[model samples]
Target: MANDPSVAHDPPPYGAEVFAFSHPAQTERLDSLGDLCDPATTADLARWDLPAGARCLEIGAGTGSLALWLADRCPDGEVTATDTDLRFLSRLRHPALRVLRHDVRTQGFPPGSFDLIVARSVLCHVPARTELPARMVSWLRPGGRLYIEDPSFFPAASSPDPVVRRLGDAVTTTLAASLGSDVAAWARSFPAPLGGLGLAELGMRVHCPTLTATNAAGRAWALSVADLLPAMTRAGALSEAGGTRALAHISRPGFVDIAHAMIAMWGVRPLTRHTEPRYAG
Candidate 1:
């Protein structure tokens, strides 16, 4: 349903004005995110030993890295990479991959559409975060897998370093205000509802990577801060000078702290008929 053209009028929080794919630094930012998180994602998926013809749906497929990986991994299968913005994805050409412009909140697929569904750093931005998991589960075939990952700033929120704390608060605050992101809440409650969705083999893991000024995680964080700086400043969550100072501090050699905890939750849809999931709104 997320590909429905009727909902084209609905604006996404990360719209062109917020974090456009056309921005000069957008590619680097997306790559950095992939660099920082893809290994763990792939590790999880690889563990499943999926069939060569597996059908995968990658929601919020930012730069298409994982989708491309899936295509290569499942050479005989289909991979649908969906995002609200398709500029970056449109550039990728692969026989097994289909790039689609989709808004997860509005568009959707028919029941039993995929063998695997995965999303990273996405549901946190959806206002209906609580309900989307059920909807996603409905799109999976029996014995299918669903994996969801999100970042939580709880550690950074309580950081001892003033600069880290300030910038972290600013970034999270700006995200919450501008994108309706409830990252912290979503992270904390991620695995709660999946059990009721007719899924089995539920599992979860939290990864908290170390952040240094020069590391991929650090660079990704800095780029994100840069992207959100304007909104942060405009909203009075962070001032221009303060943001600059924080950036400078983060770029120093000694800067070290825990980045957001990337929490990954997964479950397998049982191979039996079950009540259809209900969507909220």
Candidate 2:
């Protein structure tokens, strides 16, 4: 991913990127994952040249946005999306889409069953991602493709505001402490993990693009950090209300530089690879 130069640090929490906050006016809007799977996010999926009725699988298919997008693109394509949390399963409006509740770390489907598999902004959420490259890809047929987007920040990229910087650190630290897992560790390692799968690595790469909230809706979403601030402070992840104040400032009239970074990587799946032989999922 580092070689591709698109991967970077500083990413939004799952679903928070496009769905930064909810909108009361648009009472019938969809979930964040759906937005991320929009033309902008799923361009990579369109690039896939599989048959019309190809089989596609998406891990951590939040709200089934990506799967639905793929389904719509290849009308004949069958997509199976799995997520232990079914909070947004109904978001999928496509008939070819099948949503299931499954744990990526402990449960999955049969091997070599899919033509393509993708997990965007999901690797960081999984602890033993080392298992993903093979386990997830093992389900792919020969000549299949894999797309993985992760948070990629350079060796020296971070916030300058004392409060904001601390708040960012706190979120990662507290998340790990509370969940008994290190989310930051996984975010820091990417692209390289693919080599462990023994595939003809097309090489891991990412697009370290920064997204700035300049539009009206985007600004409103960026300012809706209050919901997350209180919990962060109470958890001792933040010492002061810096994040709260920063949110207010960034949402102001002159604010123009509050942006987030994202990394996306991809590779190809080969036939007949060593199955790591692990428990289900």
Candidate 3:
């Protein structure tokens, strides 16, 4: 969810473009996302029984709000917050926090080093997304948990309002097509992968925020769509005329839509590990 306002014009690398990282907008969206997920995040951590001094990793740590919260919760613990673009995370300085510029696609975190790992809206842009769960699992200590929150756009774009629905669908389709990956793939296909990795205690929860023109989340969505309209039109996925109509609809009073769906996946690494005899007896 971290985007660089300066890089918005340049075409994003096929599978790595972020739609909402400008200055004021990025801040707004971060606030919106925090409000939307705070309860779930708190509940998930509580379920995991996050221990004091727990080692945590937060990938795609956007403005580092969640990471900061984690640091506060685990005062004696350490939190590593990473993102490819570190600008937005630069301002978060804390004794328990370490910020890194790491690409989740290529770099690997130290194996079995963390007690908890979390990501939000990150895997959608990863080209090598399928193998990602195993990689994250590898970094977790035995019995540690991995929490991932990813977006599924279909639910949100399927508005009761015909004009909003049509435009929303068109915009997301074009965006995904241009990005060279299906951003919503996990919505229908994540549990199998977790099972394949032999993770235990698997569970998923879906969060779909209700939106209205007056609400923060709704305003953020509209602003983001408006910002992306120019690019969508130029890319030819969205016709200028269509973009105009969509933008108008999004801006109108009393407009309502569902914020994109966020699916949270949680799993625990087994505590016992099988190893070969030390002496090969």
Candidate 4:
């Protein structure tokens, strides 16, 4: 019988170093992210091709919205939605969906167990973020797909809009320095590891949408920046008055900001390799 990996360990308590995971507004932020990136995510899904009866796994399945969609699309298969904090994903109720309180850094899916693996805006906060993609890609069955979407905040930080760019750049620079995670570097060198690992058909796309208060995606972007005010202030990225002004500017009529670039990248495991026998039992 196939083992239930979810039972192998007790779900670790949710106090990880990841910024969003620790943020009080994480659920709202993740939901907003889903709304903001829905179209692009859908496009990537179409490009990668989600087949019916294809087993899927979504790491950092924040709020499980995208995971739920995957479950619906792969109705004949199973979708495992995993995160360290299950507060949001636990709410999803579907026969095809399996919710697991698992941390990607510490725990892992069985090798070659999944047909598709997806994660969005997740790698930035991870301590071993760079090493994770290789591990994740290994969990796929031969010819299976791995899709990752991470952000490059430099573009938004350098936006032509002065008011918006000032705040955006300050927060991004401060956060990256403090966390020691350079997103711009990652964006510039994405998918190279996949290629090195011998994965085939690598492809990537970068999207930077204009954010205005009128649209759901834009409002979400603004709210996400607003939510980081406290951290930005503590990090000396923005003064109290500057933060207040920036917050107000985003809400004002005709306010606009360019969102960080979302870089979507994917690769398929080669079909010629024989499935590893270690995980078959």
Index of the highest-TM-score prediction: 1
Q: Each prediction's TM-score against the native?
A: 0.91, 0.73, 0.84, 0.85
Give the Cα lDDT of each candidate: 0.86, 0.57, 0.73, 0.74
Judged by whole-model lDDT over C-alpha atoms, candidate 1 comes out at: 0.86
Candidate 1 lDDT trough over 10 residues, lowest sum: 272-281
Give the alpha carbon lDDT tens digit for every residue of 1-281 in model 3. 24766564423642244454544566666666676777777677776577678999999887787899888888899999998777778988889999998888779977989999998877766656778988999999997988887777777465677776666566566666565445456655655556667677778887777777677566666666765676677666677788777767767787777867777777888777533211100
Question: Per-residue CA lDDT of candidate 1, range 1-281, in tens?
Answer: 78887774333467566666777899999999899999988988888877659999999999999999999988899999999888889999999999999989889999999999999999888878888998998899888999999988888888999888888888788888787887676887757757678777788878888999999899999998888889999879999899998999989998899988898889888887565532211
Worst 10 residues of 2 by lDDT: 19-28
Report the error of model 4 at residue 267, Å: 0.3
Which scores better on TM-score, 2 or 3? Answer: 3
**Model 2: per-residue Cα lDDT over 1-281, one tens digit each:** 66665775443343332222243422123343244234445765665588668888888775566777778866787888877656667555677888887777677778778888878767765556566777776777887877776543231136554534554465566544433334454545655666556555454443433323455323433433444455456667654466766666555665443233345556666655654421110
Give the poorly placed runs of model 1, Cα more than 4 Å off: 1-12, 273-281
Per-residue error for 210 in candidate 2, Å, reads 3.9
Model 4 pairs whose backbones collide: none
| Residue 157 alpha-carbon offset, candidate 4, angstroms | 3.2
Q: Model 4: per-residue lDDT, tens digit, 1-281?
A: 24676564332232343345667767777777888787888777865565668999998888888998888888899999998778788779998999988878788878999999988877765647788988998899998988888877777666787877787677676556456545666765665645566677778887887777767656666566666676677778887789888768777888766777888778788887533311110
TM-score of 4: 0.85
TM-score of 3: 0.84
- Each model's RMSD to truth, in Å? 5.6, 9.4, 7.0, 8.3
